[model samples]
Target: ELAPRGYIAEGWLNAVRTREDAYPTGLAMPAANIAIPHTDPGFVAKPYIAVVKPAAPVTFNAMAGMGAPVPAQIVINLGIAEPGGQVEALQALMNIFMDTDAAADVLGQTTPQGMVDAIRRHF
Candidate 1:
């Protein structure tokens, strides 16, 4: 979605995948397991955040669990063009993850606008 909009460079997906392999972004929370995949600013043309809720859970390596697996249903893809932008975004996501109600709200959305609304409420 972001590619056609020119928010990401040609190698953005590959770069994110490579980064994910090295430093996992999965977080196991009370409401649901989630993953925030991202790469360096060089692969981004514009800063943007994309959210995906898969029909089935996807496996991801936990960020701080020493390669432990997390079955994530919510995947957040980040395209950040600034050096420290990811930190702020991650902090906001962490806030939502820490609150079970907020995380549940985000996970309950079925539409794109609904998801945006849910995230905006806690973001």
Candidate 2:
């Protein structure tokens, strides 16, 4: 999430991939298309969520240890701004993604504003 991509989903995936060698974006979720690209807070400056709706799907190293070459289309770039300011919020998201129902709820949300609203509520 160093360089942000507003709506280019593929480019956004690349940005996330650059940090995390394995693309955490397109994991095998119940949903059709999805991605979760995150890295250590060191690479980020201001913490904010960047959403990218790419024109086409992009491939990423899905299984890091497995060496399986799976790819994902959509990308969610996560940057931690003021890491100390958002620990609880970030952990909430981590927990959300861990829970199938919660992840579904997050993915079900539409529009950047929707995501923003959820983030704000967490804060």
Number of backbone-clashing residue pairs for each candidate, in the order shown: 0, 7
Superposition TM-score, candidate 1 onto the true structure:
0.94
Question: By TM-score, who's the top model here?
Answer: 1
Worst 10 residues of 1 by lDDT: 64-73
Where model 2 places Cα greater than 4 Å from the true spot, the runs are 1-18, 22-25, 63-71, 81-123
lDDT of each: 0.90, 0.53
The stretch of ten residues in a row with the least summed lDDT in candidate 2 is 1-10
lDDT of 1 by residue, 6-62 (tens): 899889888999999999999887677889999999999988889999999999999
Which digits, one per residue and each the tens of the lDDT, describe model 2 over residues 17-73? 575664333454444344556655655655666655466666655534444444544
Deviation in Å, model 1, residue 35 alpha carbon:
0.3
Give the top-scoring candidate (lDDT).
Answer: 1
Clashes of 2: 7
**Each candidate: RMSD:** 1.2, 6.0
lDDT of 2: 0.53
